[model samples]
Target: MIIPVIMAGGSGTRLWPLSRTAFPKQFIALTSNLTMLQETAARLDGLSGDDGISPMVICNEEHRFLVAEQMRQQKLTPSILLEPAGRNTAPAIGLAAIKAVEDAKLASASNELTEFPVLLVLAADHVIEDVEAFQQCVKSLLPEVQAGKFGTLGIVPTEPATGYGYIKATTSSGRLGRVSEFVEKPDAETAARYVAEGYLWNSGMFLIRADRYLEELKNFRLDIYDACVKSMASTQLDLDFVRIDKEAFEACPDESVDYAVMEPLAAKGEVVVAPLDAGWSDVGSWSALWEIADKDAQGNVMAGQDEKNFILQGSENCYVYGSAGNDGSGRLIATLGVENLVIVDTPDALLVANKDKVQDIKKIVSQIKASG
Candidate 1:
């Protein structure tokens, strides 16, 4: 059985104004009619086996209701786990791994059969246009993961994108390749070189046996493993949410899965990479959304409640988003003689930036926070 673990704790500060602290992009419907969280859960509908259980979502206490409501919309009764503080991906995943092992042990005891659950780790905010291909890629990696190999999905780079880190595979031929090295995000020239040399984008998705992951966590990051075990030692169920010990989780260190686990495993050749060619994007910025969205003949993408909410005159390669008002009406946004621009208009804030400069939106967000 495979237990899907959805990591849904992200601030999404880059896509700010539209994506705020109260409601992040994971809970928004940027690419489809369903919310991103809903879409993430929906895509797993046909992939699970007969004994597959519902997904387990890891989110913060603030977004507990949002996670529950969105999962309810999909008619999925997921085990919602709430973190008291923001500890990075390593600790977050550790908590889920511990919980999966516990659940598997309980099932084993009741059924009088040994059951080991493999975890399909996924991010809550990603856009994959080819769902079938993604599912196929995941299915292909299951056998290796069930055999105790840590599997990571690597996106086939369509372009020289410097925004994401890269993974160097030992061989790019078969269904699985030994992960040789994990490199940080590079400059444009380095990114181009990486693409030319066939490096895959680190998709932050994984498939591993629950017990295997816990063993690894104990091997390398013993501190994190201990803290997570302590946190889960006193897990309390509140309705649909699972609450951990706040003080115990707060003592955990801040680290990502790559730095704490995958990197070390890759060095030992225990990590395998599965190349995924599905059209996938993290939707980190407005430009990324524009690249995947439907565009007019003049290369303008407009998103709003009504079709007449925006007008573009001689604007090429621009993205304009007009948020709706509380009364179900949208404010008009018109752009004239502009090229390569992103204009986002919301009720409380507005963002106007060049397409090439969208990566620097975090700097602007920091400035706003400092002023307040």
Candidate 2:
């Protein structure tokens, strides 16, 4: 059995006004008609058999309804796990692993099931253009994971991007490679060097047996493992959501799966990398969304409720987002003789920033909070 765990917790402050703390990027339709969370769940359509269980989503209490509503839109009944507070990826995944183990055990006791569940950990905000290739890459990693090896999807680098971390593969045969090392985000020169040496971007996607992940977590980070086990012990199901123990989960240390498990396992030759060449983007900033969106002949990407919301004259390489209110009424924005700028108009805020400075929009959000 394959259990999909979608990690949907993020502040998404980088995308600022459109993506707020209460409403983050994952719940927004930044890339397509469906929300990013829906897209992530929809991508697993045929990969799991008809008898397969729905995906498990781990998110904070604030966005529980958002997550539920998005999944409900796709007609998917996901096992929504609600965290009391943000504890990063390690504990988030630990909660999912614990729940999966409990459910599997219950199913085994009632039926003649013999196979254990394998977790396909995916982030909710990634944009993978080629769903077929993405699913195939995930399926390819199953054999190695079933053979007692931790597997992660490493993206074949298309450029020397300094924003993402890199994974060095020691040996390669076809799509599978032995994970040699995991490196942090590097400077331009170092990123170029990594790309030249054939390093892959760490996509943060993983495939591993549920029990194996719990075992490894216990071996490496006992504090996290113990806290998760305790929290799951008192899980209460509240209207299709599994609520963990608040105090217990808040006591868990905050850390990512990379530092807690993957890196250490890579050194022990227990981790494998499946190179994925699918067109993938994290959409970390406004510029990234512009790069992937369809543009007009004038090199402008405009998004709004209607085509008349924005008018461009002699504008090139600009991204303009005009958001409307509940009644579908918004101000008409006109741009003239502008290039390489991002203009976002919301009900409460309006942002007109140079394209190169979009990465620093978080600072603006910080200043706004400071002023209040």
Residue-by-residue lDDT tens digits, candidate 1, 227-266: 9999999999999799999999999998889889999999
TM-score of each: 0.97, 0.96
Worst 10 residues of 2 by lDDT: 107-116
Worst 10 residues of 1 by lDDT: 107-116
At residue 28, give the lDDT of candidate 1. 93
Give the alpha carbon lDDT tens digit for every residue of 36-116 in model 2. Answer: 898899889889767745899999988899998888888889999999899999999999998888787778866442677
Given candidate 2, what's the lDDT at residue 297? 95
Q: What are the RMSD figures for all models against the true structure? A: 1.5, 1.7
Colliding pairs, model 1: none
In model 1, the number of clashes is 0
